[model samples]
Target chain A: MSREWVPFGALAATVILIQLVTMFTNTQYYLTQLIMAALYSIVVIGLCLLMGYAGQISLGHAGFFAIGGYTAAVGTTLNLLPHRDHVLVRMAERAGLTIQTTNSWGVDILYFSPWITLLAALLLSGVISLLIGIPVLRLRGHYLAMATLGFGAIIYYILLGSRFLGEADGIYDVPGFGLPGGFTFDGARNNRVLSYYFVWALVIGLMVLMHNLVNSRPGRALRAIHGNEPAAMAMGVDTARYKLSLFVLSAVCAALGGVFMAHYNGGMGPTEAGTLKAVRYVAIVAVGGMASLWGTLGASVVLNFLSLRGYFGSLDDAVFGVVLITVMLVAPDGILRRLGMYTLRRNRDTAPDAFPVSAEKQVQRGTA
Target chain B: MSSELIIQYILSGVTSGSVYAIVAIGFNIIYNTTGIINFAQGEFVMLGGMIAISLVPFMPLPMAVALAVVITAAVGALAQIAFIRWLKRPHVLQLIIITIGLSILLREAALHIWDEKVRSLPYFTGTVVTSVRIFGAYVSPQVFWVLGVCGAAVVLLSLFFGRTLIGQAMRACSADPLAATLCGINQKNMVTLSFVISAALGALAGCVVSPITQTHYECGTPLAIKGFTVAIVGGLGNSTGAVAAGLLLGIIEAFSISIMPMAYKDIIAISILLAVLSYRPTGLFVRREVGALKEF
Candidate 1:
């Protein structure tokens, strides 16, 4: 479904080669580096789904991602259960009705299950997204963009001032659920490689599910809605239902990514969910070409590569802005992906209208 | 909450509400004329504040603000001529995105030019204190000045539209551009004036409100969003409606903090905007206008 697969495969293989080089060159911390990079893959995949398949814009996925990560962190380490509060428990004891805080220090209230918390985060994000999306989505274009942009800001501000959540400092030393708490695991036990494998498995499964979806009747409906809602409605497509569905699904994707991200990072903070993160995520989708999963995945990988290459430390903002502008201009599609398709067609001698090279060659022959 | 506290909150709401109203009015004017939501409108305010901050050291407060407004109004016209005119008149969504990009550029430029220090413009109404008791609640003089400036701007605008030929021509352009053009209206000039009016109003609002919120590069986006929200609540291109929505939103926000948890206070306004928009695209006060009508 994506034209970038060949280039992406080649790129991945090249990267793997580099990894081998570094590994064989008496590398000291290869394991740690690999693990760190792997966990973020899950986040990229989730972002791909939101920005790619759903045709939704979210400047706030980082906030959701942070929430997922923090929930795991806090749940494991500090435990944010109000029920476990000694004062609250004592008050409950005095009262006829009984509700106990799980932990003695008002921390055990949220220690029920990591899986439960993860599910709750996904569900909560989905529901919250639905509520926010229903209204904002009614707006046709940029108005919706501004509204969603605000949604991100509002979430970040809220997180910044919250105390138990540790404000800007973020939760640290978050526990990793390992071997049923039987095997005493160190803080650094779960590195990026563990995160990488987990995220890779998740991404592959999600890609399969999403590929099946976009190729199906429902996918047609989504495209229909995107093309023209009134026309789609005329065609008997339920736009509201579909829009709501995509929104929720995209949110779940973000949340699932977030959940993994939290466990992967051991904690999440404001910087992870800031406006810059959202903008880059949106750019990834745009560079990838909206609604193309492979394009999105490719773009995300490229962005991550660029980040590693000191893009964030120097000239990154300008580079990203330039990239976005160029894509919007010369290639509304992914750069290398589009080039590959054109080249393939040239070899096949299909004589297509879009790849102007074939037409240009014909023109030259006639003129010469 | 005490009566004193309640009155203070109301005063605060009304003051910020006036600022929102001014911003929304600016948004409505440009939107009415061009069908583009100017994301850079808040920069006009920021510009006004920053310029006033720089000028205050050299000039009186009122004079500084006046000079800032003039400068911003000129910049506004240039912005229309330079960037906006060059871009293809995009679909509504594309236009919004363009403005967003412009907003980003403007914000970064502001941060680059002027450091991120919080700058303040002196209050025009002076240091004189005027305390009013509403059920034994105290209100500041700044609120009245905010209300006064907005009222004056609206009246001046009304008179300009009703009395001046150019203003009348602008209105006619907004009403029906093809007809206005057939009647020999130079639409380019009218569009430029629209940008001028919008930017001037935004600058004026910033100058008036700087006594309260101070100035920063970051405040621009929040203010822009508030303006956008108010504009939506008021209905597209409805100046009066935007004002009303701004006031209503401000009051609702103020009361939320008093009644609900502080954490939930800000979220409530967004939730309200979403709730209202999803259920009612027509706005609280809906009016149908010809979609083809160009702007003044």
Candidate 2:
């Protein structure tokens, strides 16, 4: 049990070391992109669990992210002043779930609290994923990919076509999510350091939770399903239920990331829901050793930070495309795995406890 | 709607449907030979149109289109050789990601080669406004070109598959690769040939339909989705079913405009894809028994 905590301890140390180095160099502003990347990493790790462990690929995670972000954006930005006398609004006001704010034109607006919107976002994405997963998870390989792609296209079209959702312009001027003790999550210059630490702390907490989950019985069942669905089923594993639950769980994680990201960025756009974004998430997971949660976190932070920093410029999407192709072609297990870093089981036939073995040792063992 | 208006919608639907059928056929060819859906199939269509558009400025329209088809077919073969040839036995997921990557690369290349502005080739027979009156409705003469070329291509393909030695060898490879190898057929070459044929077919469709639907760098993705939908609706690996399903989808989309906003046009086809995938993944034409016998 203590051995399991070593990686988490090392990760926490690295996070602080990076922060300290940036602070000493007076490059605190770099934390802005890091914050965003860490938030996006949540979605990546969730996808890693689904694709890597559960053996289900989702090409529509961005749709769930958008659902969450849009829910938060719409919930906070849509004014309910005109319907203040409405029973629901009055009830919400009585319940302290509505906040009074002013628009840019100095008009009074009553909006749902960010906490409420966050809840709404999570619930909406969960329900949507459940609905989509039922029929979609039944497919395998290309069919599943296409169905999820289709689902994403539907979400994109809806986002682009709906006026209430702000159409192509998306929702902007979203209010910051207010927390206790005078803390707020937003892109405000003054809140940079706080937001950076806050987001990273959330990510680390999630990592611990995921790490525990992946080592538990469900994770073993998922690996079994990944190996052979029929065999897993014959072994009394409820394959469908496991796959469906993982789908919903990962979708909720994506939506959670979206909610925080929407609040952090102070806006949400339809482009966030695009197929390219979904593909990018998959590419990141692929670049990481798919089943290695640590590898995914590291890849997501570095790649997304670089992308957010405009390092790739106009060639951003192309770079990811190349990475995906190159990784799949050269190292189907993943680049990190090929490099002998963070080696998980080489194949499903190996014992589950044989992970963390160095590549050379594994090779020697194989020969012996 | 007036009867003429309905005729106009049907005509428009059939024209677009023919294009979708062609794209679906492109998917079916490679899928039959390799059991892998080339996600980059639609890029071949986009490349064809883009190449022909660039070439038309230098050469005549027919020559430009023909040369474009040849070039695109070569590109298809090259992609197969460079990316797909050497893998011993790749997983389906790996192939999907590879093809998807290829599609993105091809799209980005098109973007860099041609600007983002939408472009199109001149009509094959007439100008954009020159409409041929057909049964009380004015239809673009190019519509007939699309239908004629697509139909002729299908008929010719059937004949080739039925008569040619190489085509028969490809059929054998698809039927059973081990047996085909025992029969001295090069399975790899058959896969590459399948790609070339589909690419050439996609290019031809792209050129014919360019005038009606302007070509853009980003158009391949939507076309690919619609084509995949048609492919599934027709049942995977079934070319005739693809043609019928494509037309049906196109007509439904064309008529959907009257009931829904224009921006929601793509949603109509995709929703159909999802519905069919859920309810009848074996396709509309395949019998339940036959579908059950085959693995999806």
- Each candidate structure's TM-score, on Cα atoms with residue i matched to residue i, is 0.80, 0.96
Instruction: Summarize candidate 1's per-residue lDDT along A243-289 as a digit string, tens digits.
Output: 77876777677667666556555677867766656666666666765
- Every model's DockQ: 0.15, 0.45
- Residue A137 shift from truth in candidate 1, angstroms: 3.3
User: Which residue pairs in candidate 2 collide?
Assistant: none
Clashes of each: 13, 0
Count clashing pairs, candidate 2: 0
Over the stretch A50-138, how does candidate 2's per-residue lDDT look in tens digits? 98888788899999899999999999998999999999999999999999978788999999999999999999999999999999899
Residue A236's lDDT within candidate 1 is 96
Cα lDDT for residue A28, candidate 1: 26
Candidate 2 segments exceeding 4 Å error: A343-368
Under CAPRI classification, how is model 1 graded? incorrect
